[model samples]
Target: MLSLFTIISFVSIRLAMQHLTSLFKCQVFTALVCLLLMGLPGQSYAGKILVYPVDGSHWLNMNILLLELHKHGHELTVVRSSNSWYVPEQTKHYTSITIPTSHASNLEDPEYMAAFLKRNIEIRSRDRSLSSFVALQQQTLTLLMEAHNASAHMVRDILHNKELVKSLKNARYDMMLTDPGFAGGVVLGRYLELPMVFNVRWITNSEGHFAIAPSPLSYIPTIGSHVSDKMTFVNKLKNLLHYSIGQYIDHGITRPLYQGVISEFIDPNTNIYSLMQGADLWLMRVDFVFEFPRPTMPNVVYMGGFHCKPSKPLPPGLEEFMQSSGEHGVVIMSLGTLLGSLESEISEIIAAAFARLPQKVIWRHLGERPSAVGSNTLLVDWLPQNDLLGHPKTRAFVTHGGTNGIYEAIYHGVPMLGLPLIFDQFDNMVRLTSRGVAKVLEVTALDVDTFTQALRDILDKEKPYRENIRRMSQLHHDQPMKPLDTAIFWLEFVMRHKGAAHLRTESYKMPWYAYHNVDVLAFLLGSITAVALLFLLTCRGLCRVACRKRPRDKKTKDKVQ
Candidate 1:
């Protein structure tokens, strides 16, 4: 009986041991499979990203970009202020940080900045009078200073924030993309040692195509450069003067303050514009259709059409209204962000212009109803601009020449009647006009008669401008990839390569004079001066030697001998 019991116990123990060993092996195999899957790039390499918008609510372009990027599986962190009107409802997808921007907006008061700059320039230029030169100098200084301050504050805040900084340290980003309007993005990008990219709201004609700095005077004032198609001598001088003054302000005041504040959080090596200089990519939100042909930097990528992704379904009475306009086509009218036809006179003039047009007009009038709007015209506070422009029935656009408006029209292959108001709108219209894709009508020159005639001529039988629009449409779409796809491809490409060092060539790799195109003139001037000095020295030596050892003249020969 004892032997039988021992045999039973041993068999039971052996069976239990075998089952335990099989379970252990299965668990190990499962863990190894998980590790292998996670090791793959598509699973493990999703990175952290931060997007900073200066005017977050008004940043329609950047907002659309955020949507597109979110769709790509990026973990985005948006840092905006409380005053910003547009808030994303879905915070689950993004890590939204709402910072108080009282300091930010206060830093941008135009009058205070302008006055401070005026005083500074008055002290520097020794001109008490508020002349146009002084005015220009003051305005330029104000813009630069505002930009400098905003950037400094933003950088300091981000780097000093215990949570933000800690997050950055723990979870390094793959890239930083921003609108140039945000000062801190460039600064923070540098601090975090990530690749930086810029999205310009305005297109460039002379002010280095599409990368937003201060608005170039040639474009701002609507003045064409007679000297160089890119920039006039005066424009170049203005840019230089602005840059010098700005650098002085930054180095003298802004940098020290920023460095002191930021040192407590980040490394001391961060300089103003350090991130911008270190950027691996710069994608401009400028479409070729809006800007005139000019010099372009290799780092600059035009991606204006990327954000033209349309919103939801069209509102009531839009489709039928467009259909009733006729088989020929319809015209859409909108004055962009800043300017509005709120004033009675401007509204009346616009109303009269639309009334005279035979084509149906969809006008975005933000103010009170005009006493006289034609049966063919429909007025709304806002319109689905991209959707409307993309419609086959849409023909010509009457606009204030905002970059967004220009790109939408171009993307839809519609011609324009640009009535530019302020800022780079004037330059945008000029480029569109020069390209023959659009005609420009000055806002100051607007009247019922001229506006109507211009609209008629564009929609008329000649159709020269329509052909231009078609050509540009083809060029815009003929790219190897869509603008959004291209941007995403490059962004991911940079991340995969751990920041594209090959793309970040030092601006000074070519000599300074060569970079600025001053080498030829510098060499010529240097050569001429050297030759002149040699000639003068030779003449002086010859004169002295002749006096000392020349054959005596007839009058003085006997005396010399």
Candidate 2:
């Protein structure tokens, strides 16, 4: 198990032994060789790693990371449910640790996700009113409840499996790599006394930063707030309200869901709301290039656009279609994996809009074909999204504002026409729009005329979107190192150090008042008030004594007269 440094040093010593023997003793040379091997552990021999990943589209990026780990000769063992829809049972990159699970039209079921999206679209498309907003909040709560319940069930199964627990301990994984969106992995990592590194943007309850770092509501917009960093007074108020709602969901819906399982299975004293915050390292899936500038932690590493890369050759016939667009180039559209479908009327409008455009269009349409689809449009069940976005001919992107797609667009410098339907897409689009690289349209307000004009504006050479996005792309590429490589470095850094306790903040262990210094502020204010009151009393007493002395002096003067 020689390291890169060891191999080079050994070769140099063998070649220069005659010269070295004249300068140093044999023991010195031996010690130098040992030091080379021991001190320069360029990754410490790729230690064993355990992965707990989320399924569906989330698995796609996690798989990329796992493959990279495998390339470095790290052994990976992934924990998955039997009902997982995306994670494969077998892969050369990692061994599967599958748990038995039962499901019917529920979590990981295509129908369930489809129905959820459908319901979300319905709620969002409704008129803006109190009832509608309330309904949306309720829907969000329900979804959280169901998702955490399923995760808790899987966690319980894993913990209760006596044989599996013993096997896990015996295998001795160096650390746990996971998506903190689910609490199961965090709890388990603690149980095994293993350091944790999170591949994350979202946690169980809200955004990961809100849970781990000092996030100010003044500028950091909440997810569902539909606001930006440079917010107006009203917009700032909206952000605060939305953040409060998020806290409500975190406490009311998510905490309750996992509280029982955590108390019974993991540590009883751990708080579900902040459990994920205790991870040794956070490999943030986004960076300042895409996300707005905000306070971040030392352990939080930004690796946005890590999955993006130079365009490879397009699939058969795809290059021909892209080339056929000529002067106008091409427009690409994708709504992401789970929520790719659109209503019949909306699809009709979008297709009609595409038909009028001179540029050739490629849409990742999964549902029924639209009647008004253009002859120039290519509808595929799936497409090489990164390849197409990275293509030189990709003039504009129409997307649902998934973080992956947005980052890919940013990486390729592709301006966007946003149709943000649900989840973080709405806020993601808000950021893009504020940057002037995107045109956002309300789903309910979308029409053939508006959709056509928006697409045309993005494709128009005179528009600033192209230039703005190109600038963003430049900034994203200007990093000292690639995001993926940086992620790997930190991952290995954690393993080499056993854990990054120094980088990790202990503020997570403190109560809210203590963390915020509320108690400290209260004590200081009380001390100052007490000192002021005492000073005022002494001044009043001196004034009274002086008045009494003046009266006595006047009476003595009268007696002398």
lDDT for model 1 comes to: 0.66
lDDT of 2 by residue, 1-561 (tens): 889999999989887987777567877888899998676534546899999988777788899899888877788999998988888999788899998966311547777878877887798788889988999888877777777788877877788888999999999899999887867788788778899999998887667788777788999987789998999999999998988888887888777777787888777777776678788999989878778899988999999989989989998799999999998899999998886668989999999999999999999998799999989999988999999998898999999889899999999899999998778999999989889899999877899999999988898889999999999999999999999999998998898889999998888788889998999999999999999989999999999999999999999999999
- Against the true structure, what is every candidate's RMSD? 10.2, 8.2
How much does candidate 2 score in TM-score?
0.87
Reference-based TM-score, model 1? 0.71
The global Cα lDDT (0 to 1) of model 2 is 0.87
**Highest TM-score against the true fold, candidate:** 2
Q: Name the regions of candidate 1 deviating beyond 4 angstroms.
A: 1-45, 56-58, 87-93, 106-148, 201-271, 287-290, 294-298, 309-313, 508-561
- The whole-model lDDT of each prediction reads 0.66, 0.87
As a whole number from 0 to 100, the lDDT of residue 371 in candidate 1 is: 84
Q: What is the TM-score of each candidate against the true structure?
A: 0.71, 0.87
**CA displacement after TM-score superposition, residue 510 of candidate 2 (Å):** 0.9
